[model samples]
Target chain A: MSITREEVLKMAELARLEFSEEELDGFTAQFQGILDYIEQLRQVDVEGVEPTSHVSLSADFDPRMFREDEARESLPVEEALGGAPDPAAGHFRVPKVL
Target chain B: MSLRRIEEADPALGAFLTCDPGRVLERAERVDRDVKERPLPLAGVPVAVKDNICTRGLRTTCGSRMLEQYVPPYSATAIERLEAAGAVVVGKVNCDEFAMGSSTENSALQVTRNPYDLDRVPGGSSGGSAVAVAAGMAALALGSETGGSVRQPASFCNVVGLKPTYGRISRYGLVAFASSLDCIAPLGNSPRDIALLLGRIAGRDPLDSTSAPAPVPDYVAELDRPPGRLRLGVPKEYFGQGLDPEVKAAVEAGIRNAGKLGCDVVEVSLPHTRFAIADYYIIAPAEASSNLARYDGVKYGFRAEAPEDLMDMYRRTRTLGFGPEVRRRIMIGTYALSSGYYDAYYGRAMKVRTLIRRDYERAFEKVDALLGPVSPTAAFRIGEKASDPLSMYLSDIYTVTANLAGIPAVSVPCGFTAGGLPIGMQILGNLFQELPLLRLAQAYIREFPVAPPPLRV
Candidate 1:
């Protein structure tokens, strides 16, 4: 399966990442190689095989495994916001979204 | 003693991304003081932490420029447990950026070389954790594994590493690479130390609902139990093409040693083994893409300096924050999970994962545990596979299957190459069978103790 520069760009956009021209070329080639390598998975006869999203789910579902949703002690808002790169009045300050 | 070693050798070895001697000493003193009131199991033991696991107030960089200064607000459950059990935190060690690569060379922060051979790569993303334990900088270290992060490095560094059964340890604050496959593992000089660390950390935690509700066994005590007439399976697929001759020989010797310990060793086939890499690459990256989407410039971590709007900021910030390998994985994951391609890649890989898991299940039905090589080869020279991403991914060929299967596996030092690089034999157990695996490893180590590498540090 041949990958196109446009597809790479679309992936970049979807991933919320940007690549320089040089880095993009390198990444595209490496990506193609990886894609080719992973293409081997297509050969497996997966008909009727149950897809495992996570190993924990492989077991019968148990509602008791989940913690009580009741509110408990949590990090203070100050601590929660402490790592934010841009913080303002009780919120993370980001650039204009609209 | 660990502090002194760190002071003496860490400068040259680059094993730590953050080692504050004063802070470590203070914690050690506190441990000493607290022991007077009540005895702690790990009293005064110095421990190194991988940068990916959160240590509140300490920068958990995940070896990425994105989180270079991002100190977590809370500690991971493993870290909290270790500290509660009287272990002192030595420092945060380096890892592949966001624990994404097979070698520490992907670390954007610093380079951690193999203590065995400085010119060679420390099998990573847990390279620094392995280095810290191997070089005597710490008695124990916490390393996280998505693929071969812990076991591969343990093999390279000649330290004992354990990737416990999935959910054996809580992932409350471990910086997620792939949520489905991620595990917080332990590294130490001996199987006993690993057992001690594992015992302290493995248990049900309310913070992480995925942590198994099963009771945590006394792993240290389990090590003393004799492994009598255990059925040890040697996976035929693990010994196939691409396995280095030296590594193969060493693992063969390890299998023989197990037989000498009264084990009924038999060759077993994990038929879906070859598909593990492709399945893992797809599944892990797909999960990583979603997990990492939270790293937008808004809340935490690095943000682009200037942007016209939010989208531009998100794009530029991630571009600048994440290193190449991280970017590559994110892109792959994005593509795999994207619409139209989902079933072909992510969906199919998940089914292949079931086949892989079933292979282990079937093997375990006949054998108590499986023995194999932890890595295809020992430490390679730095930059040897840096430019070739595919080659680097292949280094994890033997290791990723355990993660995919969600089984407990350990890396035990077996023998060394003629050139003196370390080789490790991997012992994998059925779900929550860490006890038998540790016992078998301890028994093997007792029988054939491999000499440590000549300490260049």
Candidate 2:
């Protein structure tokens, strides 16, 4: 169950994070420990048990109570873009992807 | 008055991350003016909120550098309700970075110390909220519990923490960690205070679809009736190894006292209890990985100065913004949900979660409630478990089951350890049975009568 350096790198990439060489080394070791600990789950016999995605739904939960799918007022553009790091004319600015 | 007290006391405790006296005074004055005509349940009471819950126009950091200056545009439904009830917002308290760790040590902003012993941690990620109540800085506090965040800290600080059934309270503006497990809870000095806060905040919200449409009960009124011959289950797995002997003794004494109070204590088994941590780690991170993907550099929060490309910006921003613990969790979650490994990790964890839930269902069939220790031991020194993450995760063994089962649970001060640190006993009830849970806690508190932490500024 030990995770490799390549695997850690892949995970960091997938998570949109970068690690230094020292941090990568440390994380590799720690991930091994955590994964090993998590490996204990394999011991449980989960043959036909249904996976529970939401604990609140096991008993009394309803979906029909959700708000009607009618159109509603949304946040004003200025308020919506208030926290943006870089903003153009009524839009969030990001680095060129093309 | 509360601001003055907090100003004098909070420097010693490091409980609050942000406090606005101007806003608080304005709110208090409005409450005073309104109260002459109609009664407000929490009129003029000062309430501190955990930094993770959103408050309009205030910085809600979630104790992370990423959100160091992030001000939420709208308030949480819980906070709106509390404010309507005339509770004054004191400030936003500290917590672990995104409520990830068991101790407040993981806070990227600052460490919140235990009010009882400055050398020890106040438990987390609701550490600051618990400390605020324990030190009399605020009359009540709002804390979110993904695992044992609320109850564990309440145990450490000798306060009352109530985590109602999942979806009992709205999670509209709560910064999501583990969506299925997260619950907005209340921490206070007394069960009555906790009940009052819970009654005000517990109900369905159109904003959060997951919130249950169940009718809110008069939790404060529920305390009047003496709990009559209630069947209490003592889960055998909780009393097993790794439990501090002092905590075990205190909880057992509390159980015995419950028997004296006409509660029929019986031994019960939750056989799949051992797998909770593993299951939790997998499922929580899997959800977190999805939830936190919104924190890229473009829209909000901290962004790196400049980057060669968008991908580099994203990587650098996340790496520098999040702390080690958060990064570790993200990595674990990403791996779990990755293409080749989803079934082996996240899928298996989900099945185990079902087994854990079933165990609680079976136990509740014969018993009205279950009782156990809130944490394995009393509060540890600040840096005691910082190096060992697994050991830190294990400390939440007894408390996480309630969250896993989506049941209502409360922690009330049972006794003090030999070292003079406080120990709390947890009472768990079936889904949406918060009234009975609060009643049981109130009765125990009446008998034990916990003393406030001796924090003199």
Candidate 3:
């Protein structure tokens, strides 16, 4: 039920986040407490129980009726990039990857 | 008038995060122009929107530093509908960062205080919205509930709050939190007001594929029907451990009052109630981990200043941008959905979720609606449960079931504690049965008229 510091670090890396040493310690401790609380679910016998991925508990849910596929106008480039911290040539500017 | 009221009360309550007077005036002028030609339902009524719900030209912060200056290009379908119904968008209000926490204290932007008493916390991530309505800053407010965000705050603030059946309201343009569980809801002074707001916003949208195509009911019209000979279930689990005695007494009195009004109040059981908090934690975080991956440095939102590489940029931006609670949830979700632990955590939680939903289905068979306390306790003081995450999560014990089952639920002011803090009575209805829920709530509100909090500007 305990999450180790190494495991926390691994999860943090997967989540694209980094923490300071002090924060890592605090998070590891808190994660352990939360996991311990959540471990109570293990006691329940979920034999043959179908997993509910969504709350469409009603019987009328149909997956086939998607919106019609059609071309439509999109946000103009200026509005789309309005909140961007760095915008150049009508695109979001990020650090060089190559 | 609402702008003046908000300007006066906001200094004391910290309810609003942003208020653009220019936009407010312009919207009011438009409503004025259209009033003569086309009479609207909510003509010139000001509304406070939770910052997570997108507004076309206004900054949608989600109470996070990540999107502090991010103005959405498009508004949420609910907001569009509200505006079309003549509700004026007053301002964006504060909330927990990414709607992660139970309290507004987690908001990276501002600390929203309870209007009832400034010392206590306004139950949140919709704290600001609830405070706005309770303090008379706005006529109505919009709140998004992932767990008990809307109802619990409504309970604490002594106002009416409603979370409709999942997919009942379109989620298009709502900033995603936990996609499966998040719901756009409302807070108001009365069930009729909540019904009016619900009627306007509840409907299918082509933009959101998950929005149910069912025809929206006339919630306002339906409120006129008298609820006669109703069967209300009192869950055995809700009255048990961890419930504040005053809150339990108040809710029980409300149930007895229902019995006096000819409701057939009966005892029922939801055996899987204990597993709800655990199930919610696992599922919400798992989905949030995936949904929040979009806030990388490349897209709009806060980006770390200088980065060595793309990977580093992503890591540093998120690390610095998100508050502690958001990072913790993302980490928990990432760990749960990780390759090795997926089955033990996320998969198992989903199965438990099915059992929780089945519990409601079984209970609803014997009753027209379920009655309980919206929150285990009334509003606790600020910073009381902030340090302990598990205790804070436990505050949502009674309210998460409706979201899990996708049933309509409303929180109505029942009574108050000795200290004068308000307690709420929650009435839950079957899937898409919002009409009966509102009728029952209207009956209760009619009998016991809840007074507004004593925080007049």
| lDDT over C-alpha atoms for residue B131 of model 3 | 94
Instruction: Estimate, for each residue in B134-244, the C-alpha lDDT of model 3 and write its tens digit.
Output: 988899999999898999999999999998888988998889999988899999999999989999998888888889878888888879788889899999999999999
Q: Write the per-residue lDDT of candidate 1 for residues B1-457, one digit (tens) a residue.
A: 9888988999989989998888988998998899999989999999999999999899889999999989899999999999999999999999999999988999999999888888998889999999999999999999999998999999999999999988999999999889999999999988899889888999889988888888888888768989878999999999999999999999998899899999999999999999999999999999999999999988899998978899999999998999889999999999999999999999999999999999998998999999999999989999999999999999999889999989989999999999889999999999988898888888889888987658777
How far residue B115's Cα lies from its native spot in candidate 1, in Å, is 0.8
Off by over 4 Å in 2: B451-453
* Residue pairs clashing, model 2: none
Tens digit per residue, CA lDDT, model 2, B1-457: 7898888888888999999899889989999999999999989989999999999899999999999999988999999999999899899999999999888999999978887788999999899999998888899999999999999999999899999899999999999999999999999988888989999999989999899998998888887688777999999999999999999999999899877878898999999999999988899889998999999988889998788898988999898899989988999999999999999999999899999999999998999999999999999999999999999999999888888888889999998987789999999999889888888888888876755545534
Best by DockQ: 2
Question: Which candidate do you rate higher for lDDT, 2 or 3?
Answer: 2
User: What is the clash count for each candidate, in the order shown?
Assistant: 0, 0, 0
Give the per-residue Cα lDDT of candidate 1 at B206. 92
Candidate 3 deviant stretches above 4 angstroms: none
lDDT (Cα, tens digit) per residue for candidate 3, span A1-98 = 77788898888888999988978888788999999999999999999999999866447565654888999998889988988888999999888889
What is the DockQ for all candidates, taken in turn?
0.81, 0.86, 0.81
lDDT to native, each model: 0.91, 0.91, 0.90
For each candidate in turn, the TM-score is 0.99, 0.99, 0.98
RMSD of each: 1.0, 1.1, 1.2
